[model samples]
Target: MQSTRKVTEDIRWVGCNDRRLALFENLFPIPRGVSYNSYLIMDEKVTLMDTVDASVTHQFIENLDYTLEGRSIDYLVIQHMEPDHCANIEELMRRYPNMEVVANQKTMQMIGQFFDISTEGRTVLVKEGDELNTGSHTLRFLMAPMVHWPEVMVTYDEKDKVLFSADAFGTFGALNGNIFNDEIDFEKDWLWDARRYYANIVGKYGLQVQALLKKATALDIRMICSLHGPIWRTDLSYFIDKYDKWSKYEPEDQEVAIIYGSIYGNTEQAVNALALRLAEKGVKNISVYDVSTVHVSDLIAEIFRCSHLVFACSTYNGGIYPPMENLLADMKALSVKKRTVAVMDNGTWAPSAGKQMIKMLEEMKDMTILDMQLSIKSTLKQERAEELAAFAQQIVDAM
Candidate 1:
């Protein structure tokens, strides 16, 4: 019943994976589900890092109980107060009556806001550089506000060289027995979801993330125990580099991502032609997506990954197509920038989506809009071969 993994000799992963949840935060789609990671440190003074979602409370409890082995919890660290990670706080407090709820002022306030828990004398209020000594392991708390939440903070275990990264460096995937990042091909399998999670969930807080990264550089973090996703015990920089790049609004790849919106598939067809042209021109890793079908989160993820982007959309009611328009809004809201973008629009009579899209893109930071704006009337005709070739060449040249 106790589905747990050992992080270190004394630190046990009392986390649980949820494969049933279709959506994370009821917005972003999590087809691979997600993991709510909590850790239990068996030291002279027992400490529970955090709690999992209510969906997997039973398994989390079992894991916690089994790891504790009748030893009462001494301290419970509240890193990020998001409901997914804090759902079991009250339940945990009820179980461990003497457990000191260790958190910052904001975190303590948020705890009271979320649950009707009496923290009269059981709360251990800590600040930015506060240290919590649990025997040989000394945890130095670093306040990482708005890394995803206001009350967010990461605990660094001085003894083990491990950083208890709350929601930072986290991904949206359930751990399928392999709890460590080295156990799976993260780049091939989990990178997309990780990008999506960061882009959609924490994309808006890039500045905050950069601040946290700056703080992290000073610490010798050998292991990263995130509140979600896989534990990082090896090649920590491999992931840390990703966080650094992503938070800087920098592209992960120099490849192109073509996101299209089509009503009767005309725009899609045009996008396909362009994609083929780009591919033929030796543009590798070209991704073509129909905005109507592919989730916007996935599109955002691809946008974050690729350096070049092409938006092909059909005009609807003298405006940008709904899905494509929605995606553009999301991009602007998430502060997506520092990339080259090409616009293509299809219209039966009037083509204004391209113009409107360019207008929207202009509002963003440092976005280079391609000069060759391809305007398709009803459909892309064979006569437009030279024009399309030139357009594709521009993208190729930009690369």
Candidate 2:
């Protein structure tokens, strides 16, 4: 049977949700699953936006078939060539033999590299600012290279004022029959996965995202139809503001997040004490996490969300703790920046994790490492109460 939803009077959603996939891109865990959003425009010339992942190819085709209602597809617009969105390209070509593939030079090159498809006479080459007229709806393509991929571009539907934002504003999580952002409590429920998706998947491409945002400012977009998660049909600025802040490496909240790596619980003890002290200083909503237990992707997401961070780790085998080191490496690799950080290290004889963490933070952009550092020998003692109080006080003062 066909499963689909209406986005407007003429456009229909032909996407499929996958809740069985444990991981996104085989990297980040998607506990709530994900959606591969493809749209169909029912104009004089039938147009399909994109295709879903191979895992949901059958469902996607069914949705397309129902939406078409015996009308032949005229064009298949290739937005991003990432395997997840382009998995059914060859299959679709075989299904719609007369349908033309609309994409840029780079996308065409990639299609050839990924599949053995003959695009000799069935390709509609487009570039930035190029328009395709399909009766009432006119689509203007805008180049958004490196937003996630080199061949990426977004289409602007002039009539409905909808921006087909490929993966630019997409998030992880399947739409549980709720297609639009306003249909759910996005801030409370979906924002966590959304932040994680952006921080881990597209976080490294902040500069490219900023460039895309700049181009979007010129267009009069009423709805944003992304390739994942929910569509933005209302309060578009709420999501747009988040994208702007995230792309600029700005914090969404002025809160503190404490991540610690404990070998035998001593370092975790110090982290607990510090967290309590910071909370006592009137800091609410402080997050505490065991770096060894939590996924590094989740840690990266928390770091991106919080304005302040505290890394507590124990030295091991004359080096920083392995778990904490992994978290720092992932953070650096994802281009995390613009946060105030405090360091704490525990060791029986020599503590180097704090110093090593400070060095790593220095490599990132605009990171403010606190001058006050805490070192613990085996376990924190009541004798060092003054020092701990002073360290916590410094964090409070900074905030």
Candidate 3:
């Protein structure tokens, strides 16, 4: 088992992001990969924040053993019931039958439905403003409904001033040694993953996010423990501010994300043309990322921050490119709202990428599709190339 990473004096990074995994949900490139972060807070009664993926059950057990030398877990707090975080809930129940599962009504419903993880024997339902006493520590449950998941709730620790936030304000990349926001290099360590996590995971519920933000405004949060990223100990406001911006779906700059999944060079060529036009258009922060080459998580992160998103796809299985298709599905699932988007499609005899994407965008709201999609038949010509350039110019102009 991998060594457990102790995040703070009382917290530990008991889970890891096998960065080697190429796909998330069997589809998106996790890139910096992912972490099923579980924490063991050696507080008053020794609370466990969450659990890890079932695949890493052995590692999780070992980390748990190390964390709880002689101490026993009195409370296993289930902040989110998503399989990634709650798959081991039953296993934990079996191991510690006396341990209480602290969660909300929605979480219990999900548990019973999915894993049949019954709280009949051991359950403690927390309400919107309920506090649980653990001797020296006071934990407050803040209901964050639909901020990614309906069952999602954040536990506030007044003693450590830590918010055991499940998925809120989390990032992607695996941590090196540092867990606190102040511990890592802000530019390199956290920025990319923060953007990716927010864009891909919690992009949908901007309003709920606003509500949660408003709710937390009164609390003096000193630390943030998220399910997928490192724990924030110092300068936690940095993450809060990022969540504020990302959830709003506001553009970070006049930049663009050129995403393409090309089997041949046709779609790539179109992307190249677009990139060239973007350069010619005096766009300074333009970036072209190949969906096939880069992870969708990173691509999503870029999309959330950029003002414009341009997609070029080589028709695959009669729709968007495989990687591009996965990216689109991820975007749709995240329920992205309010973004300017454009697309390009490539085909040998059948041209469906453009029309297909247009239809998909219809399912999305507040998305302004630019007036055109540059389509190429098998290959592209100077005229088609010029059309691509024109589209890029239009995107820049819109920005």
Whole-model Cα lDDT per candidate?
0.92, 0.93, 0.80
For candidate 2, write residues 313-384 as lDDT tens digits.
999988889989998998889899999999999999998888988998899989999999999989999999
Q: TM-scores of all models?
A: 0.98, 0.98, 0.83
How does residue 328 of candidate 1 score in lDDT?
A: 94
Please give the RMSD to the true structure for each candidate, in Å.
Answer: 1.1, 0.9, 3.5
Q: What tens digits encode model 1's per-residue C-alpha lDDT throughout 175-227? A: 99999999999989998888889999899888999999999999998899998
Which candidate has the highest lDDT of all?
2
lDDT of 3: 0.80
Best by TM-score: 2
Summing lDDT over every window of 10 consecutive residues in candidate 1, give the lowest-scoring window. Answer: 60-69
Task: Name the regions of candidate 3 deviating beyond 4 angstroms.
Answer: 1-22, 31-33, 94-97, 114-118, 261-264, 291-295, 313-330, 342-356, 372-392
lDDT over C-alpha atoms for residue 104 of model 3: 88
**Candidate 3, pairs of clashing residues:** none
How does residue 115 of candidate 2 score in lDDT? 99
- What's the best-to-worst order under lDDT? 2, 1, 3
Q: What are the clashing pairs of model 1?
A: none
